[model samples]
Target: MVNPVPILQTIATETWIPAAWEDFLTFADDPTLVGGRFYYDQGEMRIEMSPLGSAHGRDNTIVSTLINLYAAMRSFPMQGFTNTTFRKSGLREFQPDLAFYIGEPGQTITFPARSNAAVNLNEFDPPSLVIEIAASSLEDDRTRKQALYQRAGIREYWVVDVNASQVIAVEPSKATQLRRSQVLPGLEIDWVDSALKRAQTEDDGAVSRWFLGLLTQ
Candidate 1:
């Protein structure tokens, strides 16, 4: 029996509260609860209801563009998902800011475009990489979120700290920090951090041109 979880009236965002898997899904599936990013793990659920500010939005766009640019130039088979919910049904559910499937043609996944559905983690293998934009807190991204993806067997994870212009890259499967992105070899975390810093002064077009130059050279 899944008891009801309170919506905006009583429940607050950014704080974890006990919720059953079935109950969380009830709220998750409700389109009326707009702009809520959710996570469920360890019998608890957290809703990130904070609005996306310019910094967060800009970083999200730049990071996605950089990753797609890299994948394109390398001719790597890649599929990128932005703000998509991925669920492991009874155990876990995560809506990452960005996710990527990078692998051989046979290993990559193509989720249907414009689908209002969450990716079934039980049906599809975990993504090659998962990226979370650090919102009001980076600790949550570094700790709980990292543990959730690690438990899900995600290969690589990155926490993009827009305020700090830092990208904390990790290999969750190996439980190690990744100086260079393993999924996209030859791509260093430092290179990405530099791009973010440059984007502060230069427009995305300039940043793209500079970022692409590195990939080409």
Candidate 2:
């Protein structure tokens, strides 16, 4: 659930200056609210409140579980943890639905692993991959949010449109080059078409077997 605090609204108008920004940032970096939003300023952090409450359903859990298993089977040396507040593009604060640390976790100012086990945005080593489960927030997920992650230098971002049952993979490329998925590192992702194929071919039993096998393998 998101906090009810009006931090972001206040910041937008310049009604809140640097001093308030500092106070807010400090509040955000506090370890207590690790599962939600953490807004940042130059270096400080503040917890931003959201209207939605803690209401993740079973479908969310299933998707998360399946993705984790898929990554494991690929032997990527990943650590899959969900709903951790992260700083995106070193500017905006975001709580990815699920984020995977590609290798060993690293140290940072906000996430001083030694003193505070909180996942600090400043301290996040470049994540190999980040995934978002998209339902209603399709525009934000595919456009603004994707741009934010790309600018933040995320290697790969998978936006799973659950309603569509498809995954849109995004990554950075040179201005003169083509943009594509760098997570699978050259694999083609057909998004809608592939999802349609999965839906047409796989029954619930097959789908369960697919994920279970990935986890065990």
Candidate 3:
């Protein structure tokens, strides 16, 4: 086991560093650092202790609510989770800001609501969609996290750029950017972005109402 004090003290936040998967698990499971978001990519790990300030909190909640509304209105069966840990045993682990298990249009979705303690990817399927709210870690989100999820076989990944008010949605499998969500079919990325912008000025209830109108129409 790596010495917890020295490794954590010397390591930088939001930057990948060479470490064994075992070391990564040690720091990730450390009780004192429970609130820290953890990620392991191949042989490197990144620990981010982002402040859930008003902007991040607002964006996270609004986007999550928007997804719930859209999926419900479109009759798509889905389950949403906040800050769920997904561990792939020896390969990878990611605790995303938001995650969802989605079903096809008109398909009777029965995706199990796995353990909140952390979905062991070795046992259950990975989440269909994973979203990260980049309150201050946009570069890390775009590059490191992107590459990690891609290698881990995440279907759809979204990086919600809190500063720019943009949602960078992509299919890691196809290696292409997306305007419309593949898993959610007609859910437009920019529409979600617009809602973020609207959310800055308007209350969440108002923005939600606007999104509901668009969804119903």
Using lDDT as the measure, which candidate wins?
3
Encode model 1's per-residue lDDT on 1-217: one tens digit a residue: 9975556666767878999999888677878785888899999998888888889988999999998998888777898998888888899999999999897534545643546678887778778899998968688999888998999888899999878999999988677998899998888899899989998899999999999888778
C-alpha TM-score for every candidate: 0.91, 0.58, 0.93
* Cα deviation of 133, candidate 3, in Å: 0.7
Q: Per-residue lDDT for 13-35 in model 2, tens only?
A: 21213444546545456455444
Error of 1 at 212 (Å): 1.4
Model 2: residues with Cα > 4 Å off, grouped in runs = 1-59, 88-90, 103-117, 172-181, 185-206, 211-217
Q: List the residue pairs that clash in candidate 3.
A: none
The C-alpha stretches of model 1 lying farther than 4 A from their native spots are 1-6, 104-114
Go through the candidates in order and give each one's C-alpha lDDT.
Answer: 0.86, 0.52, 0.87
Candidate order, TM-score descending: 3, 1, 2
Best model per TM-score: 3
Using lDDT as the measure, what is the rank order of every candidate, best first? 3, 1, 2
C-alpha RMSD for every candidate: 3.6, 7.4, 2.7
